[model samples]
Target: MVKQFVRQKARNITPTQFIVFTYLTAVMVAALLLLLPASVKEGKSISFLDALFTATSAVSVTGLTVVNTSETFSGFGALMIMGMIQFGGIGIMALGTFLWLIFGQNISLSYRRLIMVDQNRSSLSGLVYLIRSLLLLALLFEGVGAVLIGSYLLAAGYYDSVPMAFYHGLFHAISSYTNAGFDLFGDSLQSFSNDYVLQGLTMVLLVLGAIGFPVLIELREKLVKKTPNFKFSLFTKVTVTTFVTLIILGTVGIWIVESSVYYREMPWHQQLAYSLFNSISTRSGGLATMDVSEFTSPTQFMLSVLMFIGASPSSVGGGIRTTTFAVIVLTLVNYALGRSEVRVFRRTLKQEDITKSFVVFSAAVMIVILSIMLLDALERQHFSLIKIVFEVCSAFGTSGLSTGITSELSAPGKVLIILLMFMGRVGILTLLFMFRSKVTKDRYHYPKEELIIG
Candidate 1:
């Protein structure tokens, strides 16, 4: 039976399924490894459920910790979590490809097809070259970020040991770049709110990570090939424009609402930095230099919206995705203008693309609703419903921001969050597609019927 199962799987498995399975398998393994006595600093073993929860959060790169990451886990455990984040960011398949590259193994045609689809590459022909470029780009950016952040932290006298400071820099740099929202600082970067240097470096990391892998690869190709005539694809243009617009709008909105309270305490330059960081982080990065819970009601509402929009397609961060958001907006504009085509940059958007956007959007909203209801049922608290919804959305979007209520959640509440993290990371559309099969219809004519709407 086992041999039969393996043979059947071999015949049917796709690379995307393999990638997803690899991540889920890693999550389970990491959970068990983390529960070991050596993983905890005080040598206390973690419960199965707690281990599973932590592993899911880290592997999903959601950053919602059931236990205090900084205090509960030993250095070895922290490194394990960091490894999970890196794997989650580039994807398990991509990591496997990286290993193959290091070993100088030629990428087979099948592997190339998988990489192209999984990474959302435009063309499958140069898949191996693209994968190599992506790995090099990631390393270079991460290396620079680690150095600058490490130097700043050392200058600030934040750590006594050189290795500690370096590790802290390396941890947060990778964490931020991956949009994992995990921090060596237990308070999650709040200690550096007033520190301008750290804040700026972090912002850069967030932006780079939020942009999808495809965009990064394209940008790198332009730089290396020196193709001055290289044009941005419509998808890239829309994603960049939408992301920038959202950041700007979120920054301005947060500034206006929270400036008198949160920003008033800091100098003008620092206030701008704080506002910008929160705006970028809100869209699924979840790193907050300031205490986001202390923000005014309006500011929290704004953050909820940003978190819902989240990051771009095939990026480290999650949400319905920036491209989905752009499609929805474009569709709306086309409708208002009475145009048949949802065109942008002189390119007509595909009907399938718009339909998929609606499906993704609907699935996301439904998940948020269902999660909020479940949390309310589990917690049995009198907390504001809006805040709970925000938390649910954050988890499902893999944003990891909270109103400082994650630790207070009951066991069932934590479980709910774990499920949400998995759903968000795997993505609602991907999940749907996994269970759905393509259907074929005959050419025979059927009786035409029309239904009235609205």
Candidate 2:
């Protein structure tokens, strides 16, 4: 009877659900392990809530923290956090498949499809081979970043010894590249805002991570081995164009808004560096050198816009994605130009993608609105509606930027943020798929009627 019951429970779970459940469970278990006496400083243990919160933040690749990361976690704990960042930054499935590749085991068709779909790979054929290449690319970029940043840190005397400097370099490099935004720096890079080397390396890491894996694969195939007639996928083109556009706009917006106010005393070079870093990081990488809360109201509003857009699809970062944002912009542009089709680069986008963009936009907005309502109720008179909305959007988009409201949130508000993070990471569509209703085709069609004119 027990065996039968267990079998039934297993039967009820789908592959997709299993993927999400496995990741969540693994993150929770790792968090718990990190909270163990051996993993923390002074042999201090973490409360259940604190452990769960930190674990969620790390696993979601969201940088929100309820406790001080540098103080609360020991060397062992830091390593665990680093592992979480690596796993969370790279989809768990990719890691699983990579491990399988190392063992010379063949991945099943179902698993390959999952990777292909989740990573938005160009093709499902030879997925195992692709996995190996993807893993190599990830390691290569991350390693180079670590070395570059470590060399700089060593020169700057950021740490006491070579080992410590190397470790920190590896940690931040992986974190930044994966868009995990986890920082070993006690103050989260606030002291390095004007440091040219640090800013340049971080920007490099962020761009590499935010550019989808498919782009990297294509670039590798074309540039490295001299593939014939290499063509960049539409996804790649859109992702890069959208990403660059947003960054340029966001940087300019920050520079203009904060120039005379928050950055008044800083040199122009430092101001531009800080502005661009914050602008890119706001999209997905959560590391902040400047005090985000110190931004003027207009700059804060601009950041909220960037964070809402988030990172590109299937990339380490999260958001509605650059492609989705591009679709929305294209749609608006087409409407303004009195054109029915949203054409770009000599090609017309499919109606399905346009519809998907609207759905994602709507879902994200609804979640943010609902979170704001809940936070408003819980915090009473403590925070403004705009502040609450910004915080909630940051959590939901997994952007992790805040207006000094994260640590001050009540229990209920924190829980709301947690839900938002989970929803943002897994996506609203995936959540809906879990509860999707069965559908049947209908032969009959209702008469068309116009309901409204705007």
Put down candidate 2 lDDT per residue, 1-454, tens digits, no spaces.
9999999998777655766687678767976887689778994667776777778778888888877788889899999988887887787788999888779887887788667645645367867766677788889999999998888899897876888888889999998898876787877888886687898899899888877776788888888987898787787788889989999999999999888998899988888888889889999888888788888777887888888888888778777788988999999999999998999988899997899789889888887777778899998699887788778778877877777777788777777887777777776556655665555789899999988868
lDDT of 1: 0.83
Least well predicted 10-residue stretch by lDDT in candidate 1: 113-122
Error of 2 at 185 (Å): 1.4
Off by over 4 Å in 2: 1-5, 43-45, 120-130, 437-443
Which tens-of-lDDT digit does each residue in 138-227 have in candidate 1?
Answer: 788888999888887887899878888889999999998989999879989888777778888988888898887668877765777767
Highest lDDT against the true fold, candidate: 1
* CA RMSD, predictions in order: 2.1, 2.1
Candidate 2's clash total is: 0
**How does candidate 2 fare on TM-score?**
0.94
